[model samples]
Target: MKRIFILGAIFTLALNWSCGNKKTTEPPVVKPPVVSKPPEAFAGFLTVLTNDASRKIEIYDPTIENWNAAEAKKWSWAPTTALGFVTADINTFGGGTDFKLRKVPVWNNAEYAALTDNGFAAIIEYPSGKRKWSKRLSGNLHSAELLPNGNIAIAASDGGWVRLYASSQGPDQEYYAEYPLISAHAVLWDPKTNVLWVTGQHAITKAHIITALAVGGTDAVPELTEIDSWRTTIPSAWGHEVSAYYGNDNLLWVTSNGGEYVYNKTTKTFSPAPTAGLTFVKGIANQPSGQIVLTRPDYNKNPRPAMNCGLNDWSTSTVDFYSANGQLDGSRVVNGACFYKVKLLNSSYQ
Candidate 1:
């Protein structure tokens, strides 16, 4: 009886201890849900200016899901009476298809400067396709730049002239002040320095804008005072185009038949660009993303050589993009298209 009682007591104690040590029934941990971020958006596009009979100015988006030159065009334009402006004369401007679309600056790419091998320079409004100011002048008109004072400067290669017009006089305004620049092919207005840089066949010239003279009145005559000029960096080279280096305010991009170069504004010296030694580069565009867009006549495919700085035949169907280090990154080609120049469709101009 004593053993039984002892055994019973021990079993009861063990049972009690086991019951006490039992882990309290606990619920499992529940973690909060995770949230993910949305994908980033692309922020770049390019403007392709063609010199074909189509005379197309197309906006190309490189960020398309499956990029196709045919489908990549976001918008396009060809001069027509529907644009509310007199169409370029076919006889004078080459088959009414030679509106060489140049700088599309101002109002967030809302305005464009166009010219013909003949005497035609005009600023056309984008989307609406209306003329803000235009003029027919003598000389082989090549490029145009809008001045901060609401005037326009046009470069003519044939007559070696950079003509300034008072845009306030309206589209048909004929009066202009001329500055001689031998074989001038391109003009760019520097808003920061308030000067005009003209690229010609043999030299790059810088001119000071006489604000007092550019009052834009009927009697006011604008003047471009020659501050200085530098000879072509490449020996016997023909300067073709001049554009603001959007990545560097101290530099400007200049292309020539000899090669592509970067002109330092502070030093007034031309240096070989990353794409130096490349010949026949007609147009250049520096992008904020460190890429370089350039156009060169594909003579192999086009089978037409340039005729005395005239680009009527200097074009190809392909526009090339280079990496920041100057490697050929990619190319966009539109079959049967003659791409002469390309500009970045952004508001950035360093």
Candidate 2:
């Protein structure tokens, strides 16, 4: 009986010790949720300008989505309507503020000249922002191109002529040449062929001349002699607006009023582009990423003719991005009417 009582006491003591010293398990740890940021509206910088008299050279950085007005380094001093960037100061010719319709540039390469719709024309220097020379042509300045041999070919709408600034003396030396036409609108310098393509209110002319020419083998070189010319002559060409550019690989793209078409040089044929509702294209640019940027003025609210200069007042600027195949990639709108031309520059260029 004594042994049995001692055994029971030992068993109870062991049971109590095991129950009191039971091991406890801790809970698992958790982390808080993470947040992400959205992408930018655009990848690089863009220059936006207006057609009206009250206009500013607005610079927009689409990456951060902000307008950078203070960073603008202009090549010309007058109220600018067209832009051309060069490495040297440009020359200018004085004229009154007699304004008219502005011409859209074919490419935004480093240009040696800038034209103001107020009849002011000037050559600008890049890296220095100096005015080397300027000349007030006979009519309202639409567009101008700096030749390879240090000459300038200007398209003046008032006189319906393309003027050639011939210079054998140097960059500063210049003489003027006038070629009659219905209306000279766009002057483009294609680096690939070293040919200047000039578009007018009704026709597109192919100008060929690497060196300035003499009038009779003794006079100054005309620089640009018309080699070939063709007319789009579409229904829209009746004067609303017309813009053209060598899109890529021997294909020429033309848009007027609101109609767009592609002319294939290989087959010498034309086909309608997929430009459905995009009316009144202001400019066209081919980006390095194989995307084409087009400036579309809001035609619904934009009027064809306004007071004063009687130039069309473009509504809010609408820019569209399209693939090489004419597929609409995306689009965005900017506030303000009288929007003129839109240009894209690599962020690195800034």
TM-score on alpha carbons, each prediction: 0.72, 0.59
Show the lowest summed lDDT stretch of 10 residues, model 2.
15-24
List the lowest-lDDT window of 10 residues for candidate 1: 15-24
Our tally of clashes for model 1 stands at 1
**Top candidate when judged by lDDT against the true structure:** 1
Tens digit of per-residue lDDT, candidate 1, span 62-160? 555323435777776645566655655322443111233333433454455444444555666655657677656677666766664446777776677
Where does candidate 1 clash, by residue pair?
A: 90-96
lDDT of all predictions, in order shown?
0.53, 0.40
Task: Residues 121-190, candidate 2: write the lDDT tens digits.
Answer: 5555442334445654456565555555445556655566677665433435556666665545555554
Global fold similarity of model 2 (TM-score)? 0.59
